[model samples]
Target: MMYKFLFWLWLFIWCVQPKQSIAQTLESTSQEFLIRTISQVDFKQLIEKIKTTHPLIAPSIEMVRCIAPTLSVWCVRYTNRATLPQFLTALHAFPAVTDIQTNHLLTKPRGRLISDPLYTQQWQLVNDNINQNTLDIDIDAEEAWQINTGGYTTHQDTIVVAVIDEGVLDSHPDLTHNIWRNTHEIPDNGIDDDQNGWIDDVLGWNFKTNTNNVNNDGIGHWHGTPVAGIIGAEGNNGIGISGVNWRIKLMSLVKGQDEASIIAAYDYILTMRKKYNESGGKQGAFVVVAHASWGVDSLKAADAPLWCAIYDELGKVGVLSVAATTNNNTNVDTEGDMPTTCTSNYLVTVTNTNNFDEKITGAGYGKQSIDLAAPGFNSFTTLNTGTYGVFGGTSAAAPYVSGAIALLYAMPANRLMDSVKAAPAQTALRLKQCILAGVDPVAGLQAFTVSGGRLNLYGSIQQLSAYYGLHQSASILGSLNAYPNPIKEHLFLKVSLTGATRLTIQITNLSGKTIKSRQLGTLPQGIHRIRLEMAHLPNGIYLCVVQGSAGRQVIKLIKK
Candidate 1:
């Protein structure tokens, strides 16, 4: 009974707003609807005609609310109570109106909440023990951190991840430090400083109200904070959780209760990326990836083309959009799902997996449409209202890819990314290739996803490292060794660095799946023996990676 109820609830949520933020909509409930008119329609004349012909509702050209000048769509609001169908027929009677659509409420997923120290509890970062449960798994996040902290220093501007959600906790204790700021446009000036069509978009623009005020997550809905946190929450702060890009700049683009608002948000991301490239990175955010964990449940929507084109549009301007597949446990390839099924190279659909390395019963799957899976069940992340919780869903799964992509782009050694940035047209495809090439293959996933594996940040990093001729560039610890080959559950590491140095050691399977990771900060230069307990590991061959500031060393290990 519970399984049936949960399935029904998941389907209903997927069919409706996808998340549960509809009841918390900040948009006026005054029966306002969106209409797309012919491009040749006169803006002033249409307003006059609507007011004279139909007195039931006040209609106006949404110049401020709608950013696309090329799009002929105009938003309309009802004044007095009237039948929706009556209003639609009255408006469509005119030759100017081309199409009419209602506002689709957007939502985010919720999960069980708990408080615990990070690293150990977050199984997605590093799988603790060798258990038979395929669920005891992670994305090798800890090992990825060893490659570069999100605070990694690059000569260029900070990497920006555009989070198109309800809104983010602008003042969250863990998020405030890493939030992106528009230095080109000064705050509270009441003037268009940079003149990017916004008056004072000191951070990012809120497409719903079309204002500089982007504070939307502090209230009822708590999606953006956790989503953003998963992407790039401040790292090493001794505060809250760690994101994929700990030092990344998070830009919040507000999602509204309507399609127009969603469309406007994408336009904002598109505009910013163009400006950044056109100005040689002097202005606009260095937006590499846009995170959209929300989308239609199915591809049956008549306006699927309109929505699918968004990924292509962003891809054209050098931005990859990591979107979530439906949370409902159904094959999107047959029944079909929107945005996921959208044939855009820039769209990377992520499914969910619990700690068991197994797909959750409620998450969606597709052999051709879905790209990959990530740790989504009970992902520990930041929440709205300055709290922390576990947010579960494909929504939570997508940001893992977002953060991983951002880390690659932000890293200094990424030559391919550097080349791709020079040409925006190839950005989407190249980024997709770079990411999918490094996944750890799963046996049962062969027919479930395109990649047939889960995301492996360390593996991707190594690929880039080899491509850039930086692989094994420096071996700070000379002739390091691990004791007891083919031993069971325990190993000792011998270090030989020049002086006091911080080292990170990782034990990974041959497929580059990280099995264990340890962060040893600042040790003496002389030979020191470090004992590691790897109990519960099943018999297998594995690789041990020892990384330090100067260089990295890899050794093969076996278990019996």
Candidate 2:
């Protein structure tokens, strides 16, 4: 009896132990599944999905850094006469030349000069007859006007815009004036001049080398000079191309393509902002904008945390972080990309458009994420050695907007305030309006971007100017409110005027068409309530203009 009982107990123990081992293995397998399936999922996409499904997420503006530096050169040539065969043969014979093509003058020499070796030419033609004036281009003119009209000749503001990518050609004539100087630390002193954790950041810091070698090596992908040219090329210098905002100081925080270096560069920008603000210097407004023109592919969404954190920190300090919308052509709404994908409210995400007002085929798009489009493809700008090239990508587009922001900041008291107040928010809103108000209603907002409707710089400037005027007056008026802002029902207007005056109310769509207008009788001083019935209006965003003796104010109202 004892032997039989022992055998049964041993068998039971063996059965129970194997089952327990199998269960443990299954639990271990489940844990591994969690790491790969759940933990490894794209955080940006998950956050974006939540924001879309859940309004509480309130995904705000995010500055994306997406443009990669290109080592290739671009060149163009002009002939004494129209001779395609001779030109092609000459171009092909050139040692540095790689590709060549002809323009409309193939039949006759009357047409405009054409770009040869389109992709990798280091030199380009400057037709003396063909309005080589940069002002002829809409972007160049807009930038010039933004600076000249504002009367901001001196660099008194001294705001720093950090370029985090390849190093800058520190010696470039056009960029030398605006390059940041570490005043605290002396240059070439072999000491940590400013003692800001850097040995020598004379012009700007380079994290890639962990030193102050800001020189453009002409190789190794330090394309910082071109990026700098976009942000603050010295204007009216009679040399090279013009920058967007020539007055602002530019700081270079160089970083490699690695994630760690990128994070270090971001931290460096924040640190400088903090140190500058703490120093009690006249230029208290330090590092107002950061330009990042590179992005990771959508498949690498899991690795966007560092960029997202940098973007978030920039927003916290009132720094307007600008990022490229990417040249990947992926739907940013669905897939995730760093810097741009990180949904931070203070960031201004920019995509690329071509000179013809059409979205570049490769420019990324999204209704929820992408803020606006700017000139990108076949655009000409300053290159490395006091030269210029025609490069394409959202990278170029990002700088155009960056320069525009600088110009807006330079406007007069009223214009400056108006521009600064609404530039960030309006950038996002205006982009949405431009995209939504497409030529084809069927394709809706999506088709309008790339289907031949490029970025309208002239129109954007006009809109920004008008918006600035409206916002400035509204600030002074005070105590004015519009209910049902995303109007799904009858809209309500409440106003508190300081003095007795007649108020005129007008509602118009983006097309400048007056949808509704009314003259309100004189109202007694203090708060008064007025209502506009818009239940019959179609579903779209409308701008409500209120004109009084004070000034005109415009507010966006959506009719759902």
Candidate 3:
């Protein structure tokens, strides 16, 4: 009788265990949706309208809300399981419905060791600019280094980055020193010394099991370590490679995380940041940003409420969260991607580009959705222990921006928040704007990313310099910015100057024929707007040139 019972139990265990690994356990009764019902419709009217539009969500259970922003709101509900997918895709067309998300388990990209050399292979850092003739296909990290080498400054020693991914090789030679340690907790004491709800969390907590056991991140998982190396692999160490921020701290947040787990991770980081700042850097991690390299391909409105709600708290703490878009070559604007697609002002969505400064075949894009692109193709960084690798994906592209953000905050030349005497909220906004304002206007990306440009660290530094009056040269190069792009009737152009000087502005078509030229003699040291009439011009792309005492700058213009 005992033998027969054991055989039956073994069969049951095998069947159920495989099912858990094969598919995610979804919330059968719950669904989440985002809507613009504030002015359009009330809560009761919205729910009744959804039921009227699709009766399949019948026998509805309780409705709850995780986040209810002033303009857009997130709503949750319990509905029929069999009709959820149909109801969601159907709601895509509804004018009142902005998003229909589901409870999806996110996945991470696998990585491998590709090389065994020193820093010469780190092309993404300093592309000798001779990528078979293209001059500037790299991020120009050296220029940023000239501004600040991640060295110690008055503000802080190093900013913290909470890396959200699978797992990392904590013992890697290049990454060991930069890891974030939870000094408040007692290691291996079998007790929660800090009373933060996590025991023995000497290192960053493992959200998967809600335990301190982070070393058991599995053998095959190789994503987190490399991404961490890309962000803050100690520079000038004369050992392996250098990351975007030469001297920065990394907080490892291992994934296999669900919506609730992700929220918990952010919550933990926020708590640590608060403790650090409130205690005058005496305790807690001063995490400035969170790096999320793994995500679901598509997040229905049902799956996004908690994350959206948590992001608000993140922004309030002066932290920015950057997410990588889908890796497929398809457009995210027409299709869709998650976290990257989540509408949060605190989030920066990144795409992948290659060595030739062009979008890779498998990299995703979106004119309205994707914010920017970076070098994710065959980009070199630390792999597992004692190994260097070349990896390519949106996952790889994201850390570059993360590390770049660290560099931006480290510079004493940062005047983004210096001039206007900004409030805390405004300081965070200025940092975000500094990133968006200084991109290098890629030709092909014109219709894709919102910036229509690639990340340029040098340009960002120059922007800060000009803003702070740090540039002591009157021979300043001006920036030409045109608005209402694809203009049909009229276009407005702002010519910005660093110091007072005379300026010559002109417009031309592809044939190099001068469309118009305007001369504003000896304009004051500031911005001047020039309007170009385009109603009579043909519907084609044009160029605008700004020539002044500082230098000459040209910008591309589109007329619809």
Candidate 4:
């Protein structure tokens, strides 16, 4: 009789649970809604039209505001929340509206918080075999620091990274020296000194209230401070823990817990970066990396097209965005997570790992979507109250990658830096390639991320160094290009020469079997285009070795 009663009780609870969840979702959906409209539609005129058409509910309409003007995204709020369903149905019928989504609340994943100040406790930077943890599971930051200290670049350009979250405590003792300041704008002058449209954004703009105050609230808005510290807290300081880049600029792009505010913050970052690129890096900030440690869970890219599209826009201006996957253990590929699932080549998605170099049980993973993992569990970092604390989650994982990118930019390679200035987009893609190619392979991440590895700062620096060494011309070879790489019948090869030398081409398979060999004797000092017919070669991978007077360079080719 007791077993029968327990079975009925289980059934009763299961049936009632979903009803409660449904009611909560319905109540939450009634307040605000986000809509994407056609660009030609005047947003203010539409708001007036809605007020005139809905006479009875017009007085209850709280506010209508533009979120992303370029994307034509707007937020509509109503005081009479019960009318949202009908209002949504009515708005969907309009031709100008392309897509709509319930304005879901954006949140940072909560992590276990603890207070610790000793650098030895920061096992994420360098493992010391404490508390039965694995050694060498860290990001190899110490070794990378030997190569570049994340301070100024060889050209002495100040590298800036934008932290898009609630807000970063710019006054934090460890972070104050590294915080980015807009010298062009005057403080508290109530004027747009820089003429960037934002009034007196001396530090960074706060999109939550459209103000210059970008400090974190002492409430649950505690994620951004640690994130900024992780990216760039003043290193070698005797106060708290060290960040990834010791002498880097951290720009605080404050956001609210909603999509509108996040989009607006991105707009500010985009404008500043575009200005930097257009003005020859004289006026605006040199923001190469942007870190976003907060996002919506279970949100698909299809529903949030405008949000996903911003990553590409940021990339064109030479900014690489790093996003943390949801803290949930579910696979992001199957369940879908925003920004991670968004198909943008410029965006690097990271997941969380622990001190043991293992994916934490609570962290999200996706073999196809996630790029790599980082040490995020129990990471010792700076806090909003000018103290230190241990924070965990994918939120703590992403900034490590962002910092690594900034450090790579500081490497003393003039050739690489010139390439970055000439072709910002292409160089940004190359930077992403270096990071993905340099990750340390981890057993836990083998089936989880595209890199199948965890972040290794030293390995990435070495990879970038090797790339710079390989591309070095010694004043002989200017450039080498191969097109239609995955070839069918013919391959086009272009070689730029600064001096006369015998040019030889050799094609070899992976097993070192020479498939083709040719010597075009005594080329002049100019660009030479040659065609090779690979119609007889089978569908496989081959290496095209180009030999010149200076040295030999290898280019990987595919035939299909």
Candidate 5:
């Protein structure tokens, strides 16, 4: 009876052990490979040919999907570790394959983490002389917030900003209200509901793990949640701290530290923006700006031209990208730095500044490369633990710029919204101009940065308001109108005022050369029209700038 029992036990053990070992073996051997094919190659046919021709790797390898379908880039998963070289060789033999590269791991750049004794207040936004902070040395966020708190455009279109970093803790109390949700997508249904190629991407995409779980709780990934909080943490709810914008939508794009992963992440952003533009705000997300807080130092544009070129593509589609300079306190222009060095007007590069309104010792600076500085040292922000903490670095600085852009979009300006609808590309560049031109000149940054100043949120908002003929209050320059835009002989001007005020009209050429100027003395609270002779002016584009006692406006005119 004992011998019979022993035999039965041996048989039971033998039956289940191989199944467990096989599962472990498959998990251990799985590897990801990114492949770029020529434009004309048929993806499905090529994938099948590779599988059938290389029989040894047939059962172990599978095509994941085309990440950048427009670019013919595909990611493949191979579980036959022992036959990886054979599979690669077979792929190389195909004439359609352009390039093959394995995924490269990357680590986030570390900023100087100095603990401040007083972390209770966000002096970076107001700077009320706390902790020896210089009075009024902050971003003037209070004044800007009073003008617009940010959530949707004046046209009532929801504003969304993409945070391309590790990932965001979307469920955190302070962020839950502002987190972006794909209403078309059904959660955890094991199906591609929207058919955007990603499965169950209700929140956002995770390029690192190729999954929809963008809420990363990994050790170093703590960077993303804080960054997101700095851009759009919910405000006035009496909970935690408020971000630059209290009510803007934030999208998470989780990425690994690799060129391919970064490109894939951006491609996802490009895809969404393109869809929005094509669908007339019906199907896709309206991501106006994207923020990246991580970059590699000493990397040049020559080495990553594709990455550099992506900025231009984004700009063409009316999306601006903001990036952080390396925190090495080095001259990025000479030593070289990615992204910041990319000469795309659509790209805004930011360096770190302290509460004293001075550049930090460990932050990067370049007179021509770095655009501006922001309060990045010891600023209070949300943490991944569903709590508040002091988050700083150039990482913190970049979001201030992004939030400013989103805030500008939220302004209730009819002309501003009209311009965006008419010429999105030009409007994007104009926003960049507002940011660079409205900076508060800082003596410490004068010789080290392009703007030679720190960010002034109020000033930037004012610049946008002036450019688009918008005022904080309706009492001054209520409306401005210029007709017969392509004037052949006469250009008519109409001004609407809420109260009596003097008005000045200045017409300048595209090169900013003043072509004409007129002073229309004080007028009562009503609409008035005036005509100007334009028969002698050469054929070209011009700016009709109108200024009043309390506000200003600009109109575009074309002379025929």
Candidate 6:
């Protein structure tokens, strides 16, 4: 009788409990919601609500099962080698194929490959042993000098730097002011007001969901915010870490963990460029410096076509793409990642260096592909929590270079376009020069970097200021000109050798290593023409230094 009573009591308690769907329970609580199973009605209703409330959300509802279990399959597309009909036939033939679509592609498998044990050990040491104080080499005073003495003044004209990563924390105090504004679209209007391929790209577009909700979900990996901080954190706000160019705008393009998503983001950047050019709205020199931190270890030639196409597209419209060198410590020349190996003249491939300013052990090395190196180990930068934290990777280092480029471009007003256009080569030359001009000889100039040195922001800015200022006055001393700025096969240099007995033609990038050196047999009096055959040269910027018996003249050249 007691057992029967207990059973009846248990049944009563179970029946009286709340009868709510998992969605309702998850929606009403603060815990993370993982949608496992949904009734057809609930799923349809949820999608409809998303469409009505968040019109920019373009959900690719179809699911595609992957061979790997841990990988989150998003979307799949047909490769160039396979026709649509063939792909469809294959999909129909295979029972394992759950779903397929054309809007996006699945992310590469997150495979663990053999890494250098020594480098991995070193990384562990850096990760576990280093602190903020140890990593923060006092650059505040030097940074101040660059801003003040180097003629680095904050201009009201804003430059937009697109952070193509996971997403951004829109509410982050340090980043809010710098976020890009979509003036054409009204918020929550459920319309593509801008009509620029995105509905409401107010804080920037999210290609992951093909939506406007480009907010940091706090769990999707905090890649974008740190990158954003490196580029344009609010300066002099008495807040967290300062960005290289705080006055510029920050555009957030949410790229998911897939190549197709990245490609879509790239397309969005191009779209913005077109809009900025055709609109005639602001008329200021708008520069979009995209910071891409994602890469893989495999060397696939087929991947080259997409990257090559994107690279050419970026080059045509004067967009600078800065990519992170893979952290695999492998030789990039023999086996490199896409986009970095795209061989585009406009793309600036950067590797990682440590606090000691030494090349990070795991950082990818390439005598030909990598352009420069920047501090990446134990890097102290802003996080999505609106605070500062320590993170390290070639990923972190790429943005330092990207931010420097933005700052360099921000210096000149009327010549902003030309300045940004000339930045890659100048940056490359500066890196090369810094390495060559290093204090230690045994460290060996070439051993430091491909360009052969660390990133010197102050020196590069000083050089740019001196170079462009002279051009403004119509003076020949500062006007070192190169023809076919984007040189395909040959680069011609026109200069006036005024009272110079011997001239040494030195080509270097930002790191200060001499890329191309030629001792001009002799300078014949006045206006002279020197030709450089760049048939085998990689696409990038090279600083041509005409060091005469009298003095030195530096000119920026681009190799396509």
> Evaluated with lDDT, which candidate comes out highest?
4
Candidate order (lDDT) = 4, 5, 1, 3, 6, 2
User: Which candidate, 4 or 6, has the higher TM-score?
Assistant: 4
Across 383-447, the per-residue lDDT of candidate 4 in tens digits comes to: 87778988889999998999999999987664777887888898889888889988989887899
| Tens-digit lDDT track of model 1 for 139-224 | 66655554466543255667889999878988988789888888888789799888688888887988877887787557766788
* Clash count (model 3, backbone only): 9
Top candidate (TM-score): 1
lDDT of 3: 0.68
Q: What are the per-residue Cα lDDT tens digits for candidate 6 across 1-560?
A: 99999977775444333223322342322111122121222333433444355433323222222222343232231122213233333332322333332321122111111121221122211221223223222122123222321113233435677788888786777777777777777888788877776776677878878888888867655888888876676655655545666556778888776778888888888777766655543432254577788776656536557855785576566567888878887777778676666677677787877656577888887767777777767766668776667778998888877776666655543443454344533443442333223211114225534566556554454445444432222222322445555566877665553233576888785346777888876664344557888788754445778776655667555553
Candidate models: Cα lDDT each? 0.70, 0.55, 0.68, 0.79, 0.78, 0.56
The C-alpha stretches of model 3 lying farther than 4 A from their native spots are: 1-117, 129-133, 151-153, 216-218, 301-303, 414-422, 468-560
What is candidate 2's lDDT per residue for 303-358, written digit by digit as tens?
A: 66556767767655446678887687788777866677677766667777543345
Q: What TM-scores do the predictions have?
A: 0.65, 0.53, 0.61, 0.63, 0.64, 0.55
Q: Following a full C-alpha superposition, what root-mean-square deviation does model 2 have from the true structure?
A: 30.4
Judging by TM-score, tell me the better candidate of 1 and 3.
Answer: 1
By lDDT, is 4 or 5 better? 4
**Model 3: per-residue lDDT, tens digit, 74-132?**
55544445665544444444445544444332221101111223665676775532234
- Tell me the deviation in Å of residue 540 in model 3: 48
Error of 2 at 166 (Å): 0.5
lDDT of 2: 0.55
Cα lDDT of candidate 4 equals 0.79
Q: What's model 4's lDDT at 223?
A: 79
Q: How well does candidate 1 score on lDDT at residue 227?
A: 91
